[model samples]
Target: MRMLAVVALLNLVLVASEAITLEPCALALELTFWRMSGYLGYTLADWLCIVHHVSDFSIQPPLSKTAEKAYGIFGFSNKYWCSDGVQPSRNYCNISCEKFLDDDIQDDVLCARRVLTRNEGAQTWPQWAEKCRGKDLSSYLKDCKL
Candidate 1:
């Protein structure tokens, strides 16, 4: 029946969209790539730890309930870092927030780097100060063979 075929096609499309939207990163692999990309100001471990608390390394993190929604792996804010279309923004990263929600994180990393440079470092993220800072962050990279 055509209706059955249509339902099957819709299910297939849904599955495909879910796969595309939920591409999570593997930690060691991402770390290796990030290091090669020449990210500075924080150790890879520190970055991992910060990301752990911020978005649990989720590429498309859930939108926060607050007025200023944060996005992507680093939870870059719509208000200051990127544009989410819902809020007024400075968009200092000069990028659309939707771009951060995909598996390709090179742009996200670059934006986060800009945030670090302008905001004076990792302390720009309150989660870093509350959870990752001054902690023994060596464990974050322990399993990563990098």
Candidate 2:
């Protein structure tokens, strides 16, 4: 009986850990994006458009082409912004890339600010240039209570 109880407890712990680590992307709220925009010193509509095209607001967008290179909702590059264990990095953010993959975005916001300062503002992200530059962006914040 004791052994069975121990096994059950172990299973419960495993389930709890998985629940914490694998939080669903659906929990992301539009309000959170707006708040992030405020933190990054960007207009809500423009920031929304950029994030929409970059990671579709995913906290942990799947890594492709090369894992551990681009990460987080804003898709910060490991080569310049953050350090991935597998790559050579400038580590400008002084943060580990894995931190960007989690739901907490304060670090990602700080790093993104550095990226903008070092590069050409929003044009630092090619996706922004290709998808969001000089187009109708008010729609991104339309109907939001702001």
Candidate 3:
């Protein structure tokens, strides 16, 4: 009877720990992707202003380099979470990273280049975030806004 109780308690603790770690990291990853994408957009905005000689006071950019560096500094601020042991998030992260490297970054960089070349200004982060919420980033990068 004592052995049975111990086993049950261990199982419960294991299950609880498992639950806590999984969902939050997945949520965090989605948030990170959008935030990164938004920063990229914002950086292009700043570059555009500089090239067009817009007044520094009126111009604002996303600070993409800073954001990338921050990914190095903090955790979600620095670390990218990857879950293993037959978890969906782990598989998803690998696949997502590959896709981002192969496709999304290229497309975004091209878009950023175009936006920077135009004299017209780019949207502020709030506006960009709103637009990003609906757009999908393949499978892993989900917009949690709605």
Scored by lDDT, the top model is: 1
- Return the candidate ranking by TM-score, descending: 1, 2, 3
Candidate 1 residues 66-141, lDDT tens each? 8798888788889999997888999999999989878787887788879888986888999989898788987776
- Top candidate by TM-score: 1
Q: What is the C-alpha lDDT of each candidate?
A: 0.75, 0.70, 0.31
lDDT of 2 by residue, 42-136 (tens): 66666677778877766653447764467887788888888877788989889998888776767877887788888888889898899888888
lDDT of 2 at 145: 54
Clashes of each: 0, 0, 5
lDDT of each residue in 1-146, candidate 3, tens digit only: 99999999999978544311123234334334545334534432332222223212121221345422111001111122222222234221222222222212333333333433442334422333343334443333233332
- List RMSD in Å for every model shown: 3.2, 5.0, 17.3
Error of 3 at 91 (Å): 32
Where does model 1 exceed 4 Å of error? 1-25, 36-39
**Whole-model lDDT, candidate 3?**
0.31
Question: How does candidate 3 fare on TM-score?
Answer: 0.20
